[model samples]
Target: MNHESQKTTIANTVQLGSDLSVNRLGYGAMRLTGQPGNFGRYADWTAGKQLLRRAIELGINFIDTAESYGPGYNEELIASALYPYPDDLVIATKGGVLKTAPDNIRTDGSPNSLRRSCEASLKRLKVDRIGLYQLHRPDPNVPFVESIGMLAELQREGKIRHIGLSNVTIAQIEAARQIVDISSVQNRLNLAERNGEDILDYCTQHNIAFIPYSPLGAHPLKRGAPLANAEGILTEIAARQDVKPSQIALSWMLHRAPNIILIPGTTTISHLEENIAAASITLTADDIKLLNEAQVF
Candidate 1:
């Protein structure tokens, strides 16, 4: 695996909306918060801050977070760690979701709810205008257009630079577009989850960024779990490439589309470096074919 040669085949930067050009391999800050449900502040605040600094040092300018991540704490943590941010850093955070407790979470896309959420996020992030503000999820009780309309209104007021949607379908994306310019669509997608392929294709055709939240599998495999299926193929390719299986998975997605922007999150510095290193991996054609065909567990 000659990284120098493979580097030419992959595009490192992706446009977030029209103005912000960020690295395709970004960092997700969800894990920086407390665990069990990511409810409170991270137990190890010092270590979490160090990890975030390391991400930026590794050239990750695009950082993904949400007002709901700590219900307010995550954004505050970011400000505390890197308040006097670099000029090029683009901090993308989501609203429209509320977390009362780790287990008790709900969506509130109402105009009033969205306004409050956006304002609170601004205060927490210590930014006058958010670089990219996303609707975390569409509320079933509220009209989707109305929810999106509020974001459009905020954008017009210069509160939000760009508007994005999460957990949406093609129909939803089109509907949101009717209200305002949709900058990006984030969804759960990875080797184990391929349900968002159609959404990925739609975003690709329209030139909108497609941010995959879980570039790795969602659920953790138990210790010594059997690798009889796609996991085996992933492991085999990783061995051949002299990389970890997770790296192979992320590289496949980067190879899968030019518009993909990955936000694979981690708390440890080692895993953070590993995720960034995944960008340098370029999978072989045969490896891509087998992994594409095999069903991941």
Candidate 2:
């Protein structure tokens, strides 16, 4: 149970809103929907389902997904895999992005679009109320407040328990609080990207859960390789620690801030186990400095 392992995991526990307490190193379900760019149905549903089951066994209580991911297949995948639903598990699904192809993600944050998406997610996920529902992104075509208003209305109606935002700015968060309390802010952040650092800082100061989507890069890592190339600090520290470069990057994120929650998604059981173990890899202040300066953004 989550209450039992506060001190065991390096990333530790975070209480979202008032009730949902989940492990910091959570699992992202976006990649579960087969790949080419997270827009296609998984090639193997059985493997996808089992992956979700094993993730929970490894202490990953927060599972993140979106309606745009597989255009609805990922939510259905979670329901199929773990739908009796553990008492300690928290399922966070997103909306606002639509999959037009096997590789494209287009933002659609209209309130009607978001409401319809939430209704469908409730059915597909087989849940009366979603633990956390986030807007996938701010839509250029619609007023951002109008979209968040839809999520706030859903919370009042008991369709969503809490609200979160993704790919947003600090100003946006300030504006959104005028409408509803923001529980979490998710953005693409990693050694290769520091664009979300300001957002992460704001979340930390406000006690909002800062969930970083890609703790590791999206592509294959050249682990334990030379650090001479400037952005190779991950490999350099990884070499010193005798772990894979991906682990070092993930571990750094844990040490980077207290409010951060990592959601690193992988298909293979081996990599999943590896990712969960990264929470235990302690990075020193010096190590954090070295990795901190390796940004490509």
Local error of candidate 1 at residue 69 (angstroms): 0.8
Q: Write the per-residue lDDT of candidate 2 for residues 1-297, one digit (tens) a residue.
A: 342343223548887998788898899887777667676688899999888999999989999999988889999999999989999888999999888887566888998889999999999999999999999889989988899899999999999998999989998899899999999999888777777798999999998999987667664222221212224667777787788777887887888888888898778888889888888887766677767666533
* lDDT value, candidate 2, whole model: 0.83
TM-score of each: 0.94, 0.90
lDDT agreement with native, every candidate: 0.86, 0.83
Instruction: Kindly list the per-residue Cα lDDT of model 1 for residues 179-235, writing each as its tens digit.
Output: 899999999888778988999999999989999876776542121112212457888
Clashes of each: 0, 0
- Model number with the top TM-score: 1
